[model samples]
Target: MASIVDEDNKKLYIFDEFFRKGMLNNELAQMIKDKGYSKEVIIADSAERKSIDEIKKLGVPRIKPAKKGHGSIMTGIQKVNQYEIIVHPNCTNIQDELDNYSYKKDKVTGEYLNSPIDSYNHGLDALRMSIQSVKRKARILTVKL
Candidate 1:
């Protein structure tokens, strides 16, 4: 958290919302008050890169190489066992099916469509890694009806 601090001579404290156990660094939050420094906080994740230009306008130093599947992926099953509502577009049963994009072809000429396939299913792999890593066996699932 100190690494992200912008200015000098003024002290700042930072804290992670959930994973980091301890008190919030009110000094930094306070310093913004003490010196009247503008405070900017960023909440970022794996999918935020697409909005790079928009995020930069907020005036806070950016945290980069944003992490995915933090608490949820690494400990989601242990934290909240079971899963529901998996959604994926262009998904296929086998990895190779994903590799081939369901073998889409130009209907008119039967020529290869040649759309890049591997990129389509990567998000699902990311989700699978997170859920399976938790290794929870409880069948109870909480849902909104």
Candidate 2:
């Protein structure tokens, strides 16, 4: 997800995306360069440190590891949820993820858990990583009827 942030208004305008599976580091580097993001500071998943290093070496500048740890996912979810996210019409995958991402459900009583389901979150994870330093007080999500 490529975005422009409106910090004062707490808005995240996601304007572009490249969502493809099994892409190699070189391909990713080329994408960043082709998309004109060579100079931008990109926050990538820390889990892919080796890949990030390879991309950096491949000539895309300022690739930083995402800040992550225990409860980080939920924290990021809350942080992003506070903002009004505006997605580009062309970014269908992002729109789909935002619309479908949800909390997990309990089996026995069918209660919705606070934890978020892992599915449909790749783009969202990138978005969350992008704004790791930006903070917002978390609000508990209540399901709507």
Candidate 3:
């Protein structure tokens, strides 16, 4: 996914998202190039070093690993929540992920937990990386959308 930092408004615009299942590194690289995102900075899962290296070797430029640590998810959720996120009309995958990715709940009490549910977060995971990128640059403060 590609996002823009509207620093003036402290808002995040999810401009683009690419979601594909079961793709090889070369295929992913080709898709990035075909989409004209070969030069754009791609923030990916830190756990996928092999895949990321393979993609880099295959020629997509500026692919970076996202920050990962204890509480990173909760922290990311908080950070991203500070900005008003606006999704482009075509980024349906992102929209769906955001819509379904909710906080975990107590099964018996039905109370919202601090952690998010494990399901429905493929796009949101990427979104968190983008949020981390923005925070690393200190581009803005707070989220609401």
The TM-scores of all predictions, comma-separated, are 0.22, 0.89, 0.86
Clashes of each: 1, 0, 8
Quickly count the clashes in candidate 2: 0
**lDDT of every predicted structure (CA atoms):** 0.30, 0.75, 0.74
For 1-145, candidate 1 gives per-residue lDDT tens digits of 1112212322111211112223233432333334333343323334545443333443323322233454544343232123333223322232333243333578899886544234433333333332332222311111000
lDDT of 3 at 108: 100
**Model 2, runs deviating above 4 Å:** 134-145
Worst-scoring 10-residue span by lDDT in model 1? 136-145
**Regarding TM-score, does 1 or 3 come out ahead?**
3
Compute the lDDT for candidate 1: 0.30
lDDT of 2 by residue, 1-145 (tens): 6777777788888788887777788888888888888777677888888887888899976877888899988888888887898888999998999899898899998999998898988888788766774444321111000
**Model 1 clash tally, residue pairs:** 1
The list of candidate 3 runs beyond 4 A from truth reads: 136-145
Report the error of model 2 at residue 100, Å: 0.9
